[model samples]
Target: MVVDTEPRMLKHQVVRKSLDSLLEGMSPGDPFPSERDLADAHDVSRETLRQAIRELLVAGRIERRGRTTVVAAPKVVLPLAIGSYTEAAREKGMSATRILVGWSTYSADAELAELLHIDTGAPVVQLERVFTTDDTRVGLETTRIPADRIPGLIETFDYRTSLYAELRTRGIIFGPVVDTIETVLPDAREAALLTVDTRTPMFLLNRTSYDDQGVPIEQRRSLYRGDRMTFTAVMGA
Candidate 1:
């Protein structure tokens, strides 16, 4: 005789494990099995199978494609350090590119002045760009820098080049940076720009980078697709 004292796995949990295996062998963009078909194959009710599918959806292993579900591409992992987004994508074996969407000069408001350690009404250049990885839209970033700091930046710098690299060419050396991250819902404009559902959660990151002399270099705000982007950090005691 054998004894089994452990609690049995829930039906949905069991189904989820099986589905994970199926996803492992599936290619990105491949259609996921329909709910009815999955239920029949797993010998479970549609509602039960749905619970399992929902988990995968939230985990970014699958995504909604019109009326069907499809396997999703792997998420891009960003390190919690001062570096280039393109470099991070390359480390993950993904191609990274950016498009300049908005660029202009504006006077710093009270909040922006405080963050940039400049007087209110100081002129600053703002650059808005969208980033893509492996042909998938991944994030939008807006960077503001004091206009006087990077003279001729608007006319001389190439938007397609790395912003950090451009700064280096202008004799700007990066120092320590402060970063803040949060989960948020994008507004209509942002959702449309990213081609994501308004209800989809996003990761918002605000960063202020300093120059080697401890002067503020740039203030940047970035919104990353929750399903397509992830962040990693190294901690020491």
Candidate 2:
């Protein structure tokens, strides 16, 4: 067994370990013991117990549900590769769906023109979608596609299905993608839409997908709940 001995043990660390052990006997959504009871049982001060609980909350091991603390569902692992969110959820034995929060078509401004490598004022379809896994809202995605490449996409596309799947049907296959991630906090509007507090941490991901000829096919920005999602990468030699 591996042991963490690098950092000298702190008072809160001791309590956190004990609480982690207690959680092994518990299941997701199970109510955690009251703070007072946990402090007494762990022989720690209330402040120390709260500190430990705070650590667990940040680590995604536990979460606040209404006014009670409960064991959090295991974070969904997203592969850092060219695949859709639907595939990732499916691998975790969960159902994936999305709600189209917004959709519009507009001329590609300078920023969009640079990202999509298109001329300024080119038509682009902008899609706003909220991704849900097992009934939990986990991510918000905004996708932009050059309208001229995929004719009639706005009229024929199904908002409920995977965007990648729809693109494949129209002969647009993603070859390689570049993804960047940043840690950020949500704004009031984002918080309300995600059903999370403004203080909740989020993973902001910007991705650009390209076709075989090195043409940018799609540009997407997605925000994922840090408490409910994790990323994994595969390295090759």
Candidate 3:
């Protein structure tokens, strides 16, 4: 008697293999075939195809642009260190450009006041900017600084230039910083600005930079595109 006991591959695995075959012929930013088409072509269930596509998205092999999925560019690796975004991109041989989106002085809210160690209602400068590499927008950075700490900052400082360099020239020095990283989805406005879908995942970094005396000088919230950027860190053993 002949027994047929060979284990068959899982449906999602088969779908993944088919998708790999499809990707072999595609270039970065090239739109992938529609989900229904892929499912039919692979002879797999729609759920299985979606699972495979989600895996690809998580692995950074593909990204969703509006309603279509496309091959993604290699992620730009950035070291988790204290430095300017411009300098970091330059180290990787990419031209970094900063565009100042807006700036205004406002009364610190409860949360902002606590983060900056200032009293609520104290004046704070809110600065928003976008960072791009090779003309591709990659990150959005919003910073809040105690207005009393940087006199004439709103009127005299060039918001389009390197803020850290400007602060250094003004005798403001950086000390230790506390940073936290999280994953988030872009809001509608952020999606429009980053040219990504609202559901696209991103890296949100919250950092508080301190002065030499350990006083908080600035609180920064930065959103980086997950498909376009990666963060690395080196630890001593």
The lDDT for every candidate, in the order shown, is 0.90, 0.89, 0.87
Ranking by lDDT: 1, 2, 3
Give lDDT tens digits, candidate 3, residues 1-237.
Answer: 978698788889778877888788889889888889988887878898899998788667887766877897777898887778878888889888888889988999899899899999999998999999878888999999999999988889876578899899989888989999999999999988888778778999999999899999899999998878899988789
Residue-level lDDT of model 2, residues 1-237, one tens digit each, is 989779789999989998889888999999888999988988889999999988888788998877888899888888878878877788879999888898899999999899999999999999998999888888999999999888887788888788898888878767888889999999998887888789889999999999988899989999998988898999899
Clashes of each: 0, 0, 0
Clashes of 3: 0
How displaced is residue 234 in candidate 3, in Å? 1.9
lDDT value for candidate 2? 0.89
lDDT of 2 at 156: 85
In angstroms, give how far residue 87 of model 2 lies from its true place.
Answer: 2.4
Q: List the residue pairs that clash in candidate 1.
A: none
TM-score of model 2 (CA atoms): 0.89
lDDT of 3: 0.87
Candidate 1: stretches off by over 4 Å: 1-15, 39-51
User: Which model, 1 or 3, shows the larger TM-score?
Assistant: 1
State which candidate, 2 or 3, has the greater lDDT.
2
